[model samples]
Target chain A: MTALATGTGGVGSCFISQLTWLSKNLPSTRLSLCYISMIDKALYRPDYAEIDFDTALFTLEATGVEPPPISTIVEYLAAAPHNVILVDNTSAISLAEAYPAFLRRGISIITPNKKAFSGSYQLWQEIFSSATSGGSYFYHESSVGAGLPIISTLKDLVQTGDEITRIEGVFSGTMSHLFNKFAPTSGSGGKWSNIVREAKELGFTEPDPRDDLNGLDVARKLTILGRLAGLPIESPASFPVESLIPAALENVANADEFLRSLSKYDNEMEEKKLAAERSGKVVRFVGSVDMLGKKAKVGLEWVDQTNPIANLKGSDNIISFYTKRYGDMPLSIRGAGAGGPVTAMGVTGDLLKVLCQLR
Target chain B: MTALATGTGGVGSCFISQLTWLSKNLPSTRLSLCYISMIDKALYRPDYAEIDFDTALFTLEATGVEPPPISTIVEYLAAAPHNVILVDNTSAISLAEAYPAFLRRGISIITPNKKAFSGSYQLWQEIFSSATSGGSYFYHESSVGAGLPIISTLKDLVQTGDEITRIEGVFSGTMSHLFNKFAPTSGSGGKWSNIVREAKELGFTEPDPRDDLNGLDVARKLTILGRLAGLPIESPASFPVESLIPAALENVANADEFLRSLSKYDNEMEEKKLAAERSGKVVRFVGSVDMLGKKAKVGLEWVDQTNPIANLKGSDNIISFYTKRYGDMPLSIRGAGAGGPVTAMGVTGDLLKVLCQLR
Candidate 1:
């Protein structure tokens, strides 16, 4: 099968690199690039220098292709003799809206986009029904957790008589970083602020760290997870996000300013850490959805040291699905929750899953 | 899809129970018992009494027209209008020999039997070729690590850019039981006799505990794993079997006699355990295949307590596949290595995977 993949950012570059390598290695599958779009093309020229394959077949544009204006790409797909699978590596909101069109053309969409499912319940139902009716698959294994295979595991468990009662996890790399860096552990008061700065420098956090520090990114992931567990979840905005930045620091102009302002809140967090340590507990930012009692709001919780999430280090995201069959000890999945390579691998895995399902 | 499953003893009974319950609750798939063979039919009858499913189609005879022989089973499959995927849950080694014949008749085989792949390299090659030639699949995901999905993960990792350098794990549940129960703990002498007896009584170990304790069971699993990682491995018998029991214990006439003679070697193991602890390590009966210097040997390794396998508890097995792409921390798969239910679920998962591939 010939693939025409787009996007040229971090995820985009990783996908293209994998596809290019797979094209040479996998004899059965053939991949070809149809388009490459990014804010800057000069930066990626060195990365594409080794490619001996045809580049003229696709154009490298400066801006991303508009979702509604993908008719030309769709035409290229329809013209091909072999079946084509459309991979959406773009923003979630855009991909979600464009998914139905691809499904109409018998093109499967495998994405890391969390938006479509985490959107309104109507959109979620529409995407699923359209994909099923069109004899195609919509796979987003990378949406909730990166490269851990949580969705597939859950699917297998549910299909084989295991009933999941609660789905809980440290669903964010950003939050994991915050706790790992800031938590009191024989470190100075200013150590937390310095680590956050280093994280931003390493490109681990968003350009504006507020998107991560405010807990919006984690909330989106939790929303996606709840839907996968058969819950019609509310939007991420609806979840009560406990901000790491104090109200005084919220008005910072940028990441550097934000980091400088976060120092004031460190003492307050240290006190909480001390209290938790005295009680023989470690703090972890956790997201949980409990179905055993009355259907409740799925949101983040502060887990104790005894909890699996509390033990998670670095950027590791750990998920524990408590089920009737599994009893007290839930089926746990732990691994690198966020990274360019790992997240891209998650997307790649989801793409393969769709390809495997295609007849 | 409607499935007509045959047989109901040992692992077959577990599969039937799982399939029956899943089909009823989740009505996405329907299961019908086409045939059932049992030494004592009373066990299954009373257990299934409360379930109001039709049993008129089922048969009771152990070896009769009810459950047809291999040839007749293939014929029934060829004549059936709906696409039938043959799942062989029997221990008949001849089923491996007949796999090619079934594939030629357009029937896919999903079996937990290891005989086909582990018998001979040439025969294993022929079986694989025949399946591909006949445009069918022969998936045995449960053949290696029960419900752990080790084979599938290895396949995926190898399919990507990962070059497996070493494959290590506790591949035998019976061995895990022996090690956990008998391997000397803090200040206690090893209870070798009691561990062996308890393992047999609980059905965790094979009828012959020697097969597990002597490392033959682990060798078979490691051989399968080596093959999956693209290694041309020798048969299980070729690997050196390190017996936990002394030479004198091997000549014992009965289980009681063997138990009586186990105390002599208890002191030796206790000393070894203490020595390992002093060196900042734990003694785990580990099976590993390392290809560091153009030579590979599947043998025992004493891993440190910090290692994943060393921390494995109970019958839980943890596998680590070290590869170039994965770096130092290889992809780790940990779960219940042995159990009728988990093993049966592995077969069920393979069935679903094959179905997905077919679609």
Candidate 2:
């Protein structure tokens, strides 16, 4: 069965490449063509179109092209003969209203998109119910911890009588990177700025690292996780986001400029690191949803050096679900949380899960 | 969906208890009755018969029942109102002949029985083909590694374009126990009699630990692994059996008497352990199936402390499947390889997998 996948930027290109690889490896599944670069095509350059295939290319007639609309895309999907799967990897800002239409038509949706799950609670419930009723599935396994199988594992645990009471973890790849680079004893001076710049060069951070350094990405992930675990989670904006970027660097022109301006905040951060080291603690950006307070927040927490999260290296994400079945010792899952191949694999894993369900 | 599980001795009772628990937890899937204790009907036992409402009960007429002459059980199964999923948790002596008849009847078999897979190669092929043609399945996930999902993982990898080249691991829990106790620094006196006695006392060894210490159990597991990985394997008896018990001890009347006479072999084992330790290695009873050689074997091998198998603690079993996709980094799976709950859970897991496929 052929699938149509959208978006081809950053993680989006990785998703496209993974689908291409899956198509070749799993002959039973294929990706025919993609709908991408319809809006501000110059802003997004994809490497997928270089391959020899009949791609339904679209671009803005002017500077702002809407690319028909979601309903039009749904209509195109309805007319297609072989395509049975719809993968939306876009950040079109209109997908929040478009997903339900695809679900109603029994077309499975496998996405890393956080919008649908973290949107209005009623709409999320409607989409969930509609997908289930239509004999199709809606999987956002990659929305939580990338490639960790967190959502699937949680579903299995709940189905098998595990009661999850508290959820705590370092959910941000950007924050994880920042802490790993800046919290070490040798993390002083201009080296911090160079490390942040290197992270951007490697595509570890967003086009604007502010989206990550400000904790919004982590907040969005935690919101989706909360909803998947059966909580009525609110918007990501409601969570208190402590920005690592100082006020002076907030208005920087681009990522390079922002990195250059971040040098001023290094001393403040280094002082905190020194104090933490003296007390045998490591600074980690932690997001938690606790049942005791029935709340969720993302903040800098001083974890003891002996704790699992404190010693986590690079962009690895670790989660501990404290449940009744598991008792005092929580069920812990740890893995590399951010990378092209890993995140792409997470999306691919979700695709496989959908295929298994549909088959 | 109730099943009438027969043979309730050793691991059989554990299966019966698991079925009962699954029935209670999943009320939609109830186990009607189980055949138990034909040898001593008057002995005090757990009440597995409590759930027998509209379900019929059949009693085995003989002690040490050897699968009821095939035709008799087939006839009994065919006449039963409910569809039966036969679970054979018996010894090799019984299962070697019983599996073919059930396969022809389209009855699903979820077994921990090692015999059928470790039997003649032709018989294994026939049973598998018959099950396929009859529109049923013969799942023996628990056969090789108890609760570790080794077969399921291998099947998944194979289905996803992974070519498995080499398979190795500690395949016997009883042997693991023996090695751990007799490894010189274990402080269990490093005596063969003490180790064997302690293994039995700790419930790691079977009622007759001869099959384990003689390496036959590990050989059987390796044969099964070889078959599952698509290798044409010979019978378990084809592998050389290295007996730790001397000829004089082997002639002992019973297991207790054999344990009482094992002191003679202590010095020999201690010397070997010391030599291994000095060479920066730990002794493990390793089972390996080499694709290049097209053979399977179980033997004592010295592995460095850094190896995954060397770090295995207690009754932990570890498997490394070297495949084309996974390359030099073998897919390692580790967990409890023995125990009533873990083995029962493995059977339960296989049942759930069947249910998932059916759905």
Candidate 3:
């Protein structure tokens, strides 16, 4: 199978490493690196040569050509002698939109990009239909909870005719970290502003912390899950998403200005925390897709001390599927939801599954 | 593709129901149940023909012929024109021993039978090698944790080149229930004898509750996991297992006699629970595979309140995977580990994955 990779950032770099490992271990399947791209630059040959795993990135940086248009890349991959898998790790809206174009030409996709799945519902439909029409496949396990097995498990439940009544969890590692330190279940937590800043310094938050605080990331995840649960979710914006960005800072010129003014709103978050504590609960930034109710939401909720959601540690994500088959106690999965190696593991895992079918 | 099934017990009956639902919904895959069998009776046709899932169990009990030997069954399946998936939901040691024979004939197997996987190391190796040699497939997701994603998750971690350091969990639903009631983290619990009795009545334990108390069930689960994590686990008996069955009760005639004599050992368990309570911890039956140390064991452990194992509720099973990529926080999965519906869901889920390969 021919392989194409996009982006050379955190997850992309880790995926390349894992792909290298997989290529070595999987002797039955030969995965040749036929094409690779990073924003403006790309590396490929008309003959689809295998790239050296150790020096591919450095060589691409040194001697790569300017990347062609999305359609051109699709044409190249579609014409490959063997089946192709396009691994997209970047958060580029343009690239996410081009999924249908590539998939329609028989280029399978394995991605961690949430935008392709959680964007407008039309795009979601188109991507899948294109894969079907083209006799290709796509999997986005890392799109939701990174490497937490959330997507695959949900798919199994739904595919096996299990009625998923409710789906709930923390969907963002940054939000999980912020709220965990801000309103801990046991100890008295620090101020919300300080917690967010600490998460940023530790690289848990996006480059612009507001991007994490806006609740869009969590909303996007809920959209993907809600749709998978049989809800025709129009888009992430169609439902209520309680953004953490204070009104005054919502239009801040930059992340620095937003961070500097975030402390002024600490009193607001503190009040919510204290209110929850008075009722013997902790406030957590959580997302839920009510399949029975046909609703989806992402925001803060008062979680009981005994609830698994309240006891979550670090930046771990916990997802619970309340299916009819599973009964009262939901099937829950928890772990470090996001990381270079872990997210890449999800992509690699999906690749392995795809290889089984395509091989 | 053609399908065959064995066993018509709890999981088997439930599997038929799910398979019925799946066949109606999966328009692309025509899964024809060519044959099905229980221990005493069998149903099939010389030429592979689809059986009605709704009436299969009832029909088998009414007019089924006596089951042929394992080799004969394999020979019949191997002669079938189409690819075959053999769904074995039985605990028959004889059937477990025949996995290699079936796989070597290009007959794929999807099962929840722990005996097939956690048996002798040679059998484990043989089953896999036979699958490769015959170009067949097999998956045993329900072996460890019912419908939980334990096996699939571990495979992803290992296959993606993540170094798994340790795996620790409460593997048995019966044990989880017994300990959660007898030594709950935040509650004053009942006597071990009474807890065991309650669990038995609640359908949490095997018919012979002593079967659960013997700890071999948990040992078998640990063996499967240990081997998957790259250990050459000789067998479940190769590890040190702490059985809950008292020395005197070990020779009890039946479940009733065992339960009547169980109260005699209440003090033994009380002491262990008290010892844990003295340290502000709870004692729970648990299993662990230390990959780096190359050791595996199953026994009772004093767990701190913060540990997920201590706070487990009902019959939920929790597994934590500590891997090099995941770092300090282990990837953990928790939920209903056993039940007719859930266990069958695992088998059905595995069948779906195997279908992807075999189709």
- The better-scoring model by DockQ among 1 and 3 is 3
**What would the per-residue lDDT of candidate 2 be over residues A1-359, giving only the tens digit for each residue?**
45454655656667665665666777665455534543444211132232222232323223424455567666666555544567666655587667778888777787777778877777788898878676667887767776555776566444444356888888877777767776742334235667777888888888888878888777887787777676787687776767777888888788778887877776777777778878878777898887656788888888865455675566767777776544454545555666555555567776775665455
Candidate 2 pairs with clashing backbones:
none
Each candidate: RMSD to true structure?
A: 5.2, 7.2, 1.1
Model 3 stretches with alpha carbons more than 4 Å out: none
lDDT of 1 at B308: 53
RMSD of 3: 1.1
Counted clashes in each candidate structure: 1, 0, 0
Q: Per-residue lDDT of B201-241 in model 1, one digit per residue for the tens?
A: 88787666665666766777777777777876667676665
DockQ per candidate, 2 decimals:
0.33, 0.14, 0.89
**Residue B79 CA displacement from its true place in model 3, Å:** 0.4
Q: Report lDDT per candidate.
A: 0.65, 0.66, 0.90
Q: How does chain B score by TM in each prediction?
A: 0.85, 0.84, 0.98
Please give, for residues A1-359, the per-residue lDDT of candidate 1 as tens digits: 54544555667667776776677787565554443445333111212222223342134442324433466555555555556676667774755776776776777777777777677777777778877777767777778776666777777766777666988777887777767666523342235667677788888888877777776666777677666766776676665666666788788787778888877766777777667667766555666777665243433344554354665556767776776644554556666766666667777677666666654
Candidate 1 local Cα displacement, residue A56, angstroms: 7.4
* Real A-B contacts recovered, model 3: 0.86
Please identify model 1 stretches exceeding 4 Å from their true place: A1-5, A30-82, A177-190, A238-241, A294-314, B1-6, B25-58, B61-72, B177-192, B291-300
Query: Compared to the true structure, candidate 1 yields what TM-score?
Result: 0.86
Q: Number of the top candidate by TM-score?
A: 3
Residue B214, model 1, lDDT: 65
Ranking by lDDT: 3, 2, 1
Residue-by-residue lDDT tens digits, candidate 3, A1-359? 55665567899999988877877887566777888778878999988887888688998999899998888888998998888999988888999999999888898999999998999999999998999999899999999889889999999999988999999999888888888888887789998888888788888899899888889999999999999989999999999999889988889799888888999988989999999999999999999988888989889999999898988888999999999999999999999888888999999899888898997
Ordering by DockQ: 3, 1, 2
